[model samples]
Target: MEQRKEITMSRLQRFLVVSLIAVFVATLAPAALAESYKFGASKPGGSWYPIGTVLQRLADKNYGDKVTVEIGGGTGNLLNVMSGKLSFGLASATSIQEALKGAKMFKGKVAQAKKVRVAAVLYPNYLFWLVWAKSDVTSYQQLKGKKVNVMPKRFSFQALNQQMLGALGIEYKDFSKVNYLGFNDAVAQMKDNHIDAYLGPGEENYAPIVQLATHAPIRILSFSKEDVAKMKAANPGVVPFTLDKTNYKQKNDVNTVQTFLLIITNEDVPAERVYKLTKTIYDNLGDFAGAVKAFERVKVANATGDMGAPRHAGMDQYLKEKGLLK
Candidate 1:
């Protein structure tokens, strides 16, 4: 009886030891093998945020344990990626062009901005000028001497505001009061009637504009044909875009200047990784569009348009495969 009892006790002890070893291996193994990819986007509730989320989900689902993504600010993201602080990010064509040409925001910093290429032309962003419907401001030219909320310094929106205003022969001092507020702050100020005008680029279905329209009558001011031509002539990155009537609550079509938002990465990133990321985004376009209505127009074939820089080799490869590129 004693010998039988000893045999059972020894077998139970060995089983517990084996179970502990297996658990430890299972817990630590993935950490050692997993790879991560970072993508920078704008703040939450912004268009870039949802796009980043879609990319993250696709990477997670397709790459499994191999890759991940981190989303952050727009222009700030470009700086980070260029400095090797991030793997990839989203940027506007205008800003990217400035960076490449060492113009405006990129003056004396161009050396830090080379070899960046497009991953995709994500979507079109309209330069919006939201104003109270009661206001007499029907066009960009009429906003002269009126209070305006231009974006703050270091923000890409701010740079764009300055460039567009310059193209129209307007200056900061020309406005009665120019406040340097951010997107949320600008929306709040507009709601409170603290400012007469706020100019910036955003997705077509921006929530703040819709919410404001519900309470107060608002108008999306349009650019004149001459002004649009001047803007396009001055800044090749600026493109003429028209917002359909339904996009705004006013039920009328509005013409405006726009900049294309694009996914960008340093050319130094490995081709395989870029290929994987591009492939994942294309494979899951439906999922992205369903998640965010703003992404409804995104297509793999349209990934190369309105780009200010060359296409990344990896993305180029995928586009060639899809017959999107020659």
Candidate 2:
């Protein structure tokens, strides 16, 4: 009878050990699942889209499902984070600054701009005022009394168009007609001759613009040396940038205004996550350059050069560790 009791006691102990092991496994599973992070990017077919894809691939490869990325409109990137729709996004320094300062674009009296900070300065996005080569408009000043397609509502391009026009002492109402359209729609309108000009920021060799230039001769309105200075003074964030002839089908240099395309994140995101994302980007810098030619212009030495706002603490820490920041 004692032998029988011993066997029963041993079986009960084994069952208890198995139950505890199962409970521990169950407790740890959710933590593993919770590590995945979501990142927001701008529209597809642009520079930001590919960069986000590269980042997502790198994250999946390195972290094994620890992070994911989503793409949306660039204009809404900052507000999306503020509203908690996204964890992070790509944004223009100028727009982000205005949002932070609660300027014209933002609705509230003061925006929690301090909450949004930079991860890295990607590349210079040049403002291309594309006009038909045969169009009578030769200069920005000449665009007056001509129909212009700035950009659709709620987009960064619209804000840029307003600021630039304001500096030039021209307003949308001053133009004969102003059509607000998305990038694709604007391109279509230009092709249809419904608009005389399209003013917005883009890479020097942007595919759609290049295609347009091929079918119909297009002239990139050059900002005169004096106008360039005026723009810089009006908007300190405006950087002097030259689009080399090689960047376009037409072999002629085009000088214009430019701004930094930045990787932005909110302070609420964990510093560790930001650090990891930034590190991944820097380490795979070559791959990114291959993915997007514009990335070739991005250098660690100049990463924060044109930034209008403060860098994120996590980015600062990472850059400091690499001695990129002093």
Models 1 onward score TM values of: 0.83, 0.83
Cα error, candidate 2, residue 42 (Å): 2.4
Write model 2 residue lDDT over 266-298, tens digit each, in one string.
777787777777888888889898888888788
Off by over 4 Å in 1: 1-34, 65-72
* Predicted structure 2: lDDT: 0.77
TM-score of 2: 0.83
Write down the TM-score for model 1: 0.83
The list of candidate 2 runs beyond 4 A from truth reads: 1-34, 65-71, 109-111, 249-252, 304-306
lDDT of the candidates, in the order given:
0.77, 0.77
Q: Summing lDDT over every window of 10 consecutive residues in candidate 1, give the lowest-scoring window.
A: 64-73
